[model samples]
Target chain A: MTTNKTVRLAQRPKGPVKPEDFDIREEDLADPGEGEIRVRNAFVSLDPAMRGWMNEGKSYVPPVGIGDVMRGFAAGQVEASRHPGFKEGDTVTGLLGVQNYAISDGKGVSLADTSLAPLQTWVGGLGMPGLTAYFGLLKVAEAKEGDTVVVSAASGAVGQVVGQIANIIGCRSVGIAGGPEKCDFIKSEFGFDAAVDYKAGNLFGDLKTACPDGIDVDFENVGGDIFDTVLAQMNPFGRIAVCGLISMYNATELPPGPKNLRNVLVMRLRMQGFIVFDFIKHNQEAMTALGGWYKDGKLKFKEDIRDGGVEAFPAVLSELYTGGNFGKLILKL
Target chain B: MTTNKTVRLAQRPKGPVKPEDFDIREEDLADPGEGEIRVRNAFVSLDPAMRGWMNEGKSYVPPVGIGDVMRGFAAGQVEASRHPGFKEGDTVTGLLGVQNYAISDGKGVSLADTSLAPLQTWVGGLGMPGLTAYFGLLKVAEAKEGDTVVVSAASGAVGQVVGQIANIIGCRSVGIAGGPEKCDFIKSEFGFDAAVDYKAGNLFGDLKTACPDGIDVDFENVGGDIFDTVLAQMNPFGRIAVCGLISMYNATELPPGPKNLRNVLVMRLRMQGFIVFDFIKHNQEAMTALGGWYKDGKLKFKEDIRDGGVEAFPAVLSELYTGGNFGKLILKL
Candidate 1:
């Protein structure tokens, strides 16, 4: 028998997730079942969506139950397998939770390739965030050449991919991110046409300057003031793909939605909310296209990997809410 | 020359429009110029959209500038014409403004046929409201057979047509109106599947009971609480054709949008706002279909004709905001 160290949800978070809300535990692992494989997690992804999973409510996915292993996505190599598909030493990625080891039945598990990119990139750019930006901008928003696409959290995982992909597709990409450094990184590293520092006092003014032709597509990640301001700048028949509302995830009560929603009518806008899981069947198509872009030197990615192992999961997760993570956040176990 | 009694926008209303906000005056009407025709207005349409036109801001149409005739839709007889398309004694409908006589260039002027429906019906059922309902339900909301559609402001012009058209297309139609009388009319007269009186309290509970299968299409006319309640009960991949938001028109400041907008993502809802004018090119198709429905007695309409001529435009327009008028509100000159 082996010991598996994991983080468990101790209580449902009322507002921002606190360290006390989770309890770290060591449990004896049973041998894999007939159809299950054991994975030794190399890197666990820390996402804004985790904040939503910690709450007790109905969402796109079920909330993490109390005393259960905290739900998360991780990239790792197979340690032991009784499953027919996954063998020992095969790199795989799936919802493996915030732990050193995970047992899976090969339901959502996918083969991870680190030949072109690093193992951590599989849990960052080439993972859920990449697929989200791909399907969201192309399918949901229907972004086309000559369209002006605006992305919030522009230097982060999904936003970086969204802006870079928009550029590759012949559209003008404008990014909105916190701090001057993140903004500069989006324009210089991601090749976005422009970047606005939302943390600066002149967000609306900077947005107006960035999108002089008016925003045609809005890839919304952060909700609240940023969402509202971007909405005001949308052109007629604008398409908004609402991927996440990270700003509102930690609120104790329902926050007021965009007051300028009246523009949805006046400007004849189409606003839709979508979960990346909905496009699971089309993952191959997204992977093929994104991989091509990556190999062609058109797509670039950065990771903010922390090396404190599973014990640092609670403190590191809060960094996402505070905008402390500079890129795709990952925990190295 | 003829003396035309007109209602002009005196000042932009701060909140709900008042009599002081408009000036009722008599001006000498100019004769029809080259290719122009003059129409003697018999009935002027009083639509909730007119309230939006009163504001000094950009909308689907330009605002009615202060000191200019308050823009409106009217049906009347052509008194004089120099245009080959129109002649004296011809019944016509167009944007004739809130006045006794209007000089036009025959642009957008449609010949009214009162053989089956009344002349005022040209500006009501067979006009912008009817077109809005037809396109909104069929095209925007994409209501198909067996789909459950919920319409707000069910007794009003657009709502009545929306519910009835949904039923005609083999979809289940449910209505949310203000009072018991309006609610009863929707069921008894309009042939709706069910009606919920929003003013009777138990809005959320009643909506749940009414839409047990969950709303697939939401023909949203009245926003605010009604919109929020209906949103909570929407099914996955639901479509919302936002026709109007009359409840928010009179507010001095922007009211909070639906707090449950997060459902847009969880349920993968598609919400689009559209203007009737955007479908103007397809007006003939809509008119032909709606007129056929009217002549076949498959669609019935009632008008809340308010007398006191154009002078009463200020007071009568308020009736729409107050829910005092039933059916299609029209002001007879």
Candidate 2:
């Protein structure tokens, strides 16, 4: 009998998560059933979407129930398999949980290389975050060459790729980061045309200076005041691709509304929000293009990995809400 | 010398317009300048946009100045012309003011015929309101077939035509009118799939029932509570054509905000607004298509004409703001 260490939900969180809300417990596992494989976990993904999964609502997916293992995307080495395609020591990624071991019935399970890019990198720029940036920016936003594009959370996993991809497409990309350090990283390190530090106390003024021709497309990761300010500055017929609303994810009450909604009328702007999972069918084409870009040195990746077992679930998940993670947030067991 | 009676802007109103705000005056006739033509006013358009024309701002056009004739669109006869294209007794439509006689530079002019449709019908479906409905619904919303489309102010000038066009394009068209009379008019006269009275309470609930398939395209002319309610009922990737905000145009203060803006995040909806004046270049092709539809009997047109002299300006303009006009609002001088 194998004992599995799993991070289980002990209590529902009120606002930001507390350590006591999770309990890392050891549980005995049964033998793998027919057509099922038993895998030992190597890495688990921590993302901003996990915050929505923790709460009960009508979102893209169902919420994680109390007493259940924390829901996550994980990669692991196959220890045993009764399925046709599986073999011993094969590495795979799937919607596994925050645990040392998991059983899968071959649905959405795919083999991955831990050598080309770290297992954590796949959780970020090479994986979900990468595809999210690619499809949302190019397809949803319909970004074209010579367009002036703006992205929020510039140094984060998705924002980093969005700006770089815009650059590759011959567009001028402006990024919105939180501080001077991240702003410098996007401009110098990530090759963004310009980066705005929102916390610098002159958001609109700085944004005005950075975007001289007016924003043609805005990849909106931050909502609330930032959204309102950007709405006022958008050019006529501009498009907004809203991938996340991290600014209002943990709000106890609804944030005050966009008062300058008249600008939406005057400028004729198109603002759209999307969940990345909807692009699952475009996986092969998306990854192939991203992989080609990576190999050609046209794309870059970043991973903010936390080394710990299932015990770090609560803390790692909270880091996304608090903006503690610089890139894709991941935990390795 | 013949005297021309006209309605002039005596003062700008603070909130709702009053009778004293207009001056009934008689002015001497002036000959048309070079390349200009003189038109004797037959019909003057009364629109909610006139409210914005009273204020000094950078909109689609200049504001109506104090002591000037209230700026508007009108259809009349070319009693005299200094231009080659126009001649004496030719029926024409141009941006003539609320007056018995006006001179135009022939900068903008259209020939109107009652045999093609009624004189009022041209103003509503074949004219400005028609172009507003046609371009805003098709070009701005990018509305497609099999989409579920909903429109606010359903019995008004723009809303009625938007629903009819959505229906003709294989979309399920739903309308939000003010009363049972208008609701019936939207369903029976306009051939809309369904109608809802938002003022009957439970605005959001009514929208939900009216559009069970979920709203794919929302033509937003009345903002405030209607916009708040529509935001919640949108389907994933829904498109909103934000045309006007007649509800809040006269309000002294900003109305209370929407409650569920986070829906913009969860559903990935798009909202945009525009003015028809910006699309003058598309006039030839647009009117040709509209004329084809009209000739095929695939579309219907309606107008509500209130006849009087310059004394009718205050009463006619007031009807537009109060949901009192059944189709298009027009003042025949």
Candidate 3:
């Protein structure tokens, strides 16, 4: 019998997430039943979307119920299995909850190939974040060659992938990140064409300078003033893919939206919002392309892996919203 | 030589237009020379877009420059023609300025068939407003059968035609207007299935009641809070064809955008802006369909023809923003 250290939701967050909002403890693991498998989670992926899930209302997905195991995407190894598809010691990844051990019936679970990357990389670059960037930039924004592609939260997991993909497709990739350090990182490390430091102010002027031909596709992650600035600089018939509004995710009261939506009317822009789940049918195509790019060295990922196991889940998760984490944040179980 | 009473843009207004902004006086008009044709204007179209045209900035088209004849759409008779395409005394409609007489080379001129409809109707239902509604509802919105289509400024020219067209295509039509009289007018006169009076203070509740199955297509004419409320009630994969933003046109300062734009991400809505001119190439298709519907009694047009000719251009145009006009506002010469 194995003791599983797990984190569960205690209460819905009001503004920013607090450590007291989660109840982290140990639980006795049960053996797998018919058509079931047990996974010993190696890492728990901490995402910006987790903050939205902790809120008490309808969203892309249902809110995490209080006192229930916190839902998360995790990479692990199948320890024991009664399922025909999986044998012992098969590396896998899926929505396996925030815990050291996860019980699964093999629904969303996929084999994580160590030869392509590491086990932890499955829940990082090649995971949900990578797929989100793939579908959002290519499918939603319709980024093509000779286009100017701008993405907010550029140093983060999804944004980095979006910029790289834009470069691969021959588009000029401009990233908007906080501070000079992260801005420098995206340009030097991820090969982004240009990086604009949002914290430095002069967003509109800086963005205008970055995109001389004017923005064609905007992968909006951070909303509010940043979005408004980008809106004003959009060329005619531009596409805005509303991937995430990380700036408003933890707000106690609803904040005002982009003040420059008039640009939408004037510029004849198309603004569409989408989630990764919306493209579930095309996940395999995204995975193949992402894996190919990663292997060819055209793509690289920066995983900000934190320590202290499942007990540190709440503390590490808070870093994502505050710009404390520099990359794809993950908690080492 | 004919004496032409014309309204020229004397100066740009700060907010809601003032009559002093125009230099309304008589000018000596010359006869047709070479390929030029002279038109004696009868009716000048008064539209919400006139306010935007008065502003000094980049838009879908150039701003009405100071000292230039106020750009307007008008229907009139060709007094003389040197162009082979048009004959003398031919009823025509085009971008003839807000004047008693206009000289054109017959570039955009379209012949008005009095046998199908009246001459004034050429600048009303069969003109810009009618084509705007037709293209915005059908092409831009892609409104199909079983769609719950909602149009703001329902009693106005474009809104009335949008509702009627939605009905013709087997969709549920909902209209949002200011007062009870206009609300009653849209339902009774334009055949809108439901009418929500936005002046009734409970816009969200009333709109919810009006659109029972959630809005599929939002033909947004009025922006500001009205557009915000409509945005919140949109269904997943909903299409919002932003035909106009009448509420913000006369605003001295820009208002905050929709507070419920989060619904755009949650519901995965696609909001796109478009002008009637964007579909200029498809004008014939729209005209044929609209003319066919009008002849079949499926479409009805109400032209609010205000007397006082070119001098009334500023006052009659003001009525459009203030919601004083009942239908397609037309200034008679």
Candidate 4:
């Protein structure tokens, strides 16, 4: 008999989630069912989007039901497999929950290789965030050379990739991040043309300097006044890919508007919001392109990994909302 | 020599234009020169777009300079002609200004059949506003059948035509107007599938009932909260054509945002701001189709004409911003 530690949703938090929202308990492991694989969680990705899953509403993905395991996609080593395709010792990735072990029936499960990149990179840079940056910027935003692309949350998992990809496409990439260090990271390491320190008192000034020619494409990840400032500076026919609204995720009320939204008309701009799951058809193309970028050394991948086992889930999850991590917030057990 | 009453810009007002900002005076008309025609102005068009022309900045047309004739388009009779294309007694249209008489070089002027639709109709339904509504909604929005369309200022010139054209294309049309009467006009006169009374309050509730399936196309003329409401109700892949921002035109301060704009991504919606002048390439196609619709009685036209001469220009211009008139607001000079 084997025991596995799993985290359960104790209670749904009204706003920003706390440790009380989760319950860690040990469960007796049962035999794997047909076409099922048992995996010990290695790295669990912490995303701002997790805030939405805790809410009960209609969205791109299903809500995390009360008393169910806290839903999260994780990458790990397979402990046991009764599946025909996957075998023991094979590394895999899937929605493994906040558990040390998971049973997935072939669907939504994927194989991972550290040879391509680091194992954690499979969950961050080259995973959902990278794919999101690739498809959303190229396919949805339709970014082009000589175009000025502005991105928010510039040092985060998705934003870092988005700015780098914009640079790769011969665009003038401008990133808006929390502090000077993150801004420096995008400009120096990611090869972004410019970076704006949004935390500085002079946001409008920094934005103006960072985006001298005006923004042609804005990959919005942080919503609030940042969106408003970007609204005013957009050139004609600018495209904004609505990626995430991280700033307002914990709020119990509707966020204040960007006060200058009507600028969308005078500038002849296209501001569209999107979720990457909608581009399921482009998954292959995304992986191929991103994988190539990773190989060519044109892209920079960074991760802040915390290792403390399953009991660390609550503390780790909150760090994402607080923006405690410099890059992709991931946990390795 | 024929004497004519002319209204010229006396001074540029700081905010809401005042009557003192205009100067009405008599001007002596010169005889027609070669390639120039003398026109007796009959109807002068009053438009919200004129406010944009008052400010010294980049715009669709140059600002009306001080001491110059208050720049405006009008329908008039060609009293004397030296141009080969125009003849005496012919009804002509041009940038005839706010004067009762003018001399034209016959350059950039459109000839109209006054019998088909009155002079005011040429300004409203058959002229700029009409052409604006036709091109903005059809060419810019790319409105298609089965798509749900919502129009702000539903009983006004552009909104009325946009809603009816949506209906003509076999799409569901929902109108947002100021009152019950205008809402009724949108349905009874313009054949909009449904009408929302914005002044009645509960705009979101009314919008939900009117657009049960959600909005695919939004012909935006008014900005502010109304824009926010429509954005919340837009469906995935929706398109928004920004024609004007009447609601924000008279705003002395910054216009507050329509927050929830991030929904543009959640729904994969496209919110675009455009000026009809950008769609010059599609002019021939637009004219041919709209002309056919008008002649076949498939489309309806409306005009709000104030029976006032050049002296009434100041008062009539205020009516547009105040939402005091339905359809296109024009003045008979």
lDDT of 2 by residue, A10-46 (tens): 8878778999888889999887899999989888888
Q: Give the DockQ (2 decimals) of all models.
A: 0.62, 0.43, 0.64, 0.50
Model 1's CAPRI class is medium
Residue A198 local lDDT, model 4: 84
- Candidate 2 matches the true fold with a TM-score of 0.76
Q: What TM-score does each of the candidates earn?
A: 0.78, 0.76, 0.81, 0.78
Worst 10 residues of 2 chain A by lDDT: A113-122
User: What is the C-alpha lDDT profile of model 3 across B1-333, one tens digit per residue?
Assistant: 889899999999888999999999998998989999999999988877788788998889899999999999899999999999899889888889899999998877777776667778878888898889988888878999999999998887888999999999999999999899989988998899999999999999999999999999999988889999999889988999998887886577888888888877889899999987788667667766776777788889998888998988888899887879866789999
Question: What is the CAPRI rating of model 3's predicted complex?
Answer: medium
For model 4, name the residue pairs that clash.
Answer: A265-B273, A273-B264, A273-B265, A274-B265
What lDDT score belongs to each candidate, Candidate 1 first?
Answer: 0.89, 0.81, 0.89, 0.81
Best by DockQ: 3
TM-score of chain B of each: 0.88, 0.86, 0.88, 0.85
TM-score of chain A of each: 0.88, 0.86, 0.89, 0.86
Q: Which stretches of candidate 1 lie over 4 Å from their true place?
A: A1-46, A50-57, A62-123, A304-326, A329-333, B1-44, B65-70, B74-119, B305-325, B331-333
Tens-digit lDDT string for candidate 1 (B1-333):
899999999999977889999999999998999999999999988887787788776678899999999998898999999999988999988889899999998877778777757888888777778888999998899999999999998987888999889888999899999899989988999899999999988999998888889999999988888999898899988999998887777688998888888888889899999988777667667877888788888888878888899899999999888878867888999
What value does the lDDT take at residue A311 in candidate 3?
Answer: 85
Q: What is the Cα-based lDDT of residue B275 in candidate 3?
A: 84
